[model samples]
Target: MLSTVLLRQLTDQVQELHTTAESQLQPLPLPVLNFKPTPGSWSALECLEHLNRYSRFYNAELTTALHAQPQTATPHEVGFSWLGRKSYDTVRPDNGKKHRTITHMNPAGSQLGTEALHEFLQHQKCLLEMLAAAQGTNLNRKAVRIEFFKLLKLRVGEALQFVVAHEQRHLQQALRAAHQATTAPILVV
Candidate 1:
């Protein structure tokens, strides 16, 4: 795909994510946001916090890498590398496969609040900025170091795709948690 087209799609996804959070997730009460569907499952806030943890790392890396590249005359068509294709495919929402989260990135038992949602929104904003900066850069260049494996790198386009897809996965998880929490019977002692 053309780099401009890919970036535009990513930009739209980010905006939709922001709107979804504000409209659907943001209005929930604290107890609802913190409610877990099952004993070991994460709550809505935990999901957002998990995304926040990743954004903290990825946003910085992407910003630095984009700044280092000189702008091109036109957007280049972007293609995924072998590793990039594998990496993003694993995280895409439709994959329906569970992967274990890294310890530090896991927010399973963290004391998260509405602030978690706020942080995620802020991260989305940063992601939008990064996407804008990515235009006219070489999307096929392996510029971003993967968070899980420091030595391995992804092309800039693939990195953006991975990040947005990851967010989509967790956002759906969070929405499910919120729905279950709101609809489930509240047992009183």
Candidate 2:
């Protein structure tokens, strides 16, 4: 779970990524980045496509969660430290966790075109807006998850941390995909 401070930090990072990544995203040389040396390899387009897919998923989850009342009280404040690293990269040992696979049900992700980036931006903005609404006591409230990972349910603060951490994980992947672009392709903001 995330503390209030952590949520704020994550929100700031999300905004930063929006600016930096957007500034770099352009479509003039799409085919170069789309090239795959091997059949199993992922191209830049596919990477962005997956991010867009999860962005939609998370957007729906956040919107659905907002309607439910917390079983407990909400929190208004928490503390965070620095924002000195890149996105939360799960594969990195410093990230302190084993990497997990992200599902890609749609094999046709590359064909989505510019709509993929637009979806990602829209979802990120929507997520930040929802996070804003959860300020005040909502931060401390007990969040209701359809399925709790452990015996006890996560508090709202914890949930936000999970959300931010998860987002940071994906954000890192999106950035990593940039490396795989054929000609240093930019992802459209």
Q: lDDT tens string, model 2, 1-189?
A: 334565677689668656645665544355644544346645545656665665555456555666575424354454221220222233232475544444553333346465566666776688778766665445544443423233434454445455556655555554555555544445767
* Per-model TM against the reference: 0.96, 0.64
Name the lDDT value of residue 133 in candidate 1. 79
lDDT of each: 0.92, 0.53
Misplaced by over 4 Å in model 1 are 186-189
Per-candidate clashes, comma-separated:
0, 13
Q: After superposition, how far is residue 37 of candidate 1 from its true place, in Å?
A: 0.4
In model 2, the runs with Cα more than 4 Å from the true position are 1-3, 32-38, 70-110, 140-155, 182-189
Model 1 vs. true fold: TM: 0.96
